[model samples]
Target: MSASSLKLRMMIVTALFAAIIGVLAQVTIPLPLVPITGQTLAIGLAATILGWRYGTLSILLYLALGAIGVPVFAQMSAGVGILFGPTGGYLFSFIPTALCIGLYLEKTSFNLKNAIIANIIGMFISLLLGTVWLKYIAELSWGAAFASGVAPFLIVGLIKAVLAAWIGIMVRQRLASANLLYA
Candidate 1:
């Protein structure tokens, strides 16, 4: 493929993943402090399929859309306020989470094993950053923050990580086979 075509394909795929993140983010199970959303799963999928550069781009695009009041965030919430809200750290953490996941897979291999490991790491990154932010922002004790923000999501997060790894690898393989992705 030409360089220009490759860039175009990357852009298109990045945007698609951004949209996918937005759509999945709405799948939420409400909690006291942090609702369980599909955003982390989408982040894992984006990284597993798109790798670091485009995966991070997809997250940036998703955040930008929400910042611009696009209703692309959880519960259809948007604007800069959300980015600075209690859950903002989780949202902000997605950048590094996606970047690390993609970079890990890129440096190692884009297989199920690596993807699962990368997603697990990414899940912890989100939880750690988010819990800290929630503690300060919500003016809660550390134990309270961890209890509400991190503890509740552990099992579900693991499930989502595996799902993201499995589905992401399958989709990536198909895309590569169809000449839509360069792998």
Candidate 2:
């Protein structure tokens, strides 16, 4: 493919992933402070499959859609308020989460092991950042933040990480084999 066509393909894929993130955001198990949503899983998948550049682009696109009131955020929430709300830290953290996950795979290899490691790291990053945000925004004590934000999500996050790694590697391999993804 020509450079232009490749760029177009990447853009299309990025947009598609953004939409996927939005769709997955609705898969929520509600909680008091922040619900457990499939957003992180989608983030992991994007990073593992798309690498740093496109993965981060997809996250940025997703954020932009939500900021514009597209109702793409968790529980179909949207607008700039959500970006600045109590759960906003998690949303903001997705950028670095995706970047780190994708970069790790790009630096090492896009395999299930590396993807799992990367996603686990991404999970911690999100938890840490989101907890801090929740603490201040929600006026909760650090203990409360840890209890609600970090503690509850650990096991679930690990499960999602593994799933993302497994599924992402499979899909990535297929895409590469089909000449749909560049190395």
- lDDT against true structure, model 2: 0.94
- lDDT string, candidate 1, 64-103, tens digits: 9999999999999999999999999999999999999999
In the range 1-183, model 2's lDDT, one tens digit per residue, is: 788887788788889999999999999999988999999999999999999999999999999999998999998899999999999999999999999999999999998889999999999999999999999999999999999999989999999999999999999899878767776
> All models: lDDT?
0.94, 0.94
- Residue 40: error of model 1 in Å? 0.8
Task: Give each prediction's root-mean-square deviation over alpha carbons.
Answer: 0.7, 0.7
TM-score per candidate, in order?
Answer: 0.98, 0.98
Q: Candidate 2 at 183: error in angstroms?
A: 2.0
Ten contiguous residues minimizing lDDT sum, candidate 2: 174-183
C-alpha lDDT (0 to 100) for residue 113 of candidate 1: 96
Candidate 2, pairs of clashing residues: none
In candidate 1, where is summed lDDT lowest over 10 consecutive residues? 174-183
Residue 160: error of model 1 in Å?
0.4
